[model samples]
Target: MIHSLDPAPSAQAAMLDGATPLTQLGVIRVEGEDAAAFLHGQLTQDFSLLGLSEARLAAFCSAKGRMLASFVGFKRAHDDILLVCNRDLLAPTLKRLSMFVLRAKARLSDASENFQVFGLAGGGVPAALPTAVWSQWRDGQVSVVRLPAAPGAVRALWVAPVGAAAPTATALAEPLWQWLEVQSGVAMLSQPVVESFVPQMLNYESVGGVNFKKGCYPGQEVVARSQFRGTLKRRAYVVHAEGALVAGQDVFSEGDPDQPCGTVVEVAPHPVQGFDAIVSLQTSAAAAGGLRAGSVSGPHLTLLPLPYSLLEDI
Candidate 1:
């Protein structure tokens, strides 16, 4: 909950432009001739498909196939690529990435302070770049819709000169970010949730975070196997609870001692009643219902529908 902004308006015609904490968020700058090609081989997404106007969600993994970090990747006007992830893990994640950059032409640096980030939700997003000169990747602004049908929202970062005017679009309350994130089924991975879920566990493959046809990275073997071999045991699911929740909180099925079922991925202040979070649980426990966080006697978790369907065996 570390924010750099004051508050502003809610609904508007254009964008939800204002400084939002970005709280646990951090950014990494990658620039160079080999930046795109180099990262394509090291990360989960198909970097070759990314352009200045489109952003991609991707993950960095350990050689054993566990995720080291997950990020929302996008390109700036220049040749630079921006990797955004949870703030607390950025420094170490950067160092880890640096170790592998021995001969690559790309450079990685923290760029959190240099960027203006915001979350937009609701009916529709407007066309053009609010008040900032930052480029637009979507048709207008893009936010998640969770009405009759669920839609995946966009978490946008606009990189502009350091003291420029903030966007004139209406500012939304921070909880809207949590609400939209849950609705989109796009779970943010934190330090606690690190190395916990493989890409498919979080539905990364269904969401374009994994590219099987792409070459090798740290844990490609395990990731590819999980996708095509019918061996995935856990998957991401949206869950709502009647109490406080957090990342890494262990979830349990009724009477299941010694064997815990799942882990909480993201939790936020509920836009409505209690608290809502995203959890990755074994298909067994998830299907059994009665999933609780912390212990079998812990807060009750009610599963909700995810925005997208699973692409298992794909």
Candidate 2:
């Protein structure tokens, strides 16, 4: 459904070409015999489903079932799995993952700089991928087709080895990626916000980030409870703030100073307008509308519909 936005080959290539590789993003490689087995039991998604040409979105959580980080997980080879997350969480996350691989036949290493990550908006990909890939699409083929975040904002990826030549495209800055994240409703986990959310609170299941049927992970119990128990008090939603927003900032309802009704998950300057953010809040506070942080008179926030829907049952 996604086609190349450029009518001209040169224009398209120019949009694709760049001195600083526009397609390549920071990456980390986790390789070892036990890589898949180890990750299968540690992440929110099913690692057994990963393939050389496929990708997934998964979460790292604390043993108590609190979300520590979220990532675009994919496989480069039978032994290599890639975890793409926020730059700020790289070192610590890598260190943490490495800690658990002591005896397992797995090796975790940071590969952020070795590969380039690009966002190809619109459809120009060949038909070798999923017709509807809602999450990360890690491909290395020429003119590869990738799934988009949404129908309106079709995005593909073109990743290559370091020093790889680009296809000659305008080098849009990284902010564009962040903008897409906000608009697409992809809530990323950041440093101060680690261990703050369970997968359900962020709509991870609907987005293909959580696999309920999968064996088990750190926060499996709590996450399962939040879903099957029908006791989910919090859910992530798109929101906007009049003032600068920070992740982990408390969100209040009716200006009440009680247990924060919610917390900011992700925020970014709108590409063409005001600011945009994702907030996870208690379902009760969400129905009432008006929510603020520091003070009722301070920053007022407006709620926006998420790109995807939360399943009714769970």
lDDT of each: 0.70, 0.70
TM-scores of all predicted structures: 0.84, 0.84
Can you write out model 1's per-residue Cα lDDT over 228-260, one digit (the tens) per residue? 886678999987787899889999999575678
Model 2, C-alpha of 233: deviation from truth (Å): 1.1
Candidate number achieving the greatest TM-score relative to the actual structure: 2
Off by over 4 Å in 2: 1-25, 123-129, 134-151
TM-score of candidate 1 against the unseen true structure: 0.84
Per-residue lDDT of 21-115 in model 2, one digit per residue for the tens?
33323566788888888999889988876776677788999988888878777777788877777788888778887777768998888777776
Clashes of 1: 2
Q: In model 2, what lDDT does residue 128 have?
A: 46
Model 1 ranges with Cα > 4 A deviation = 1-21, 128-159
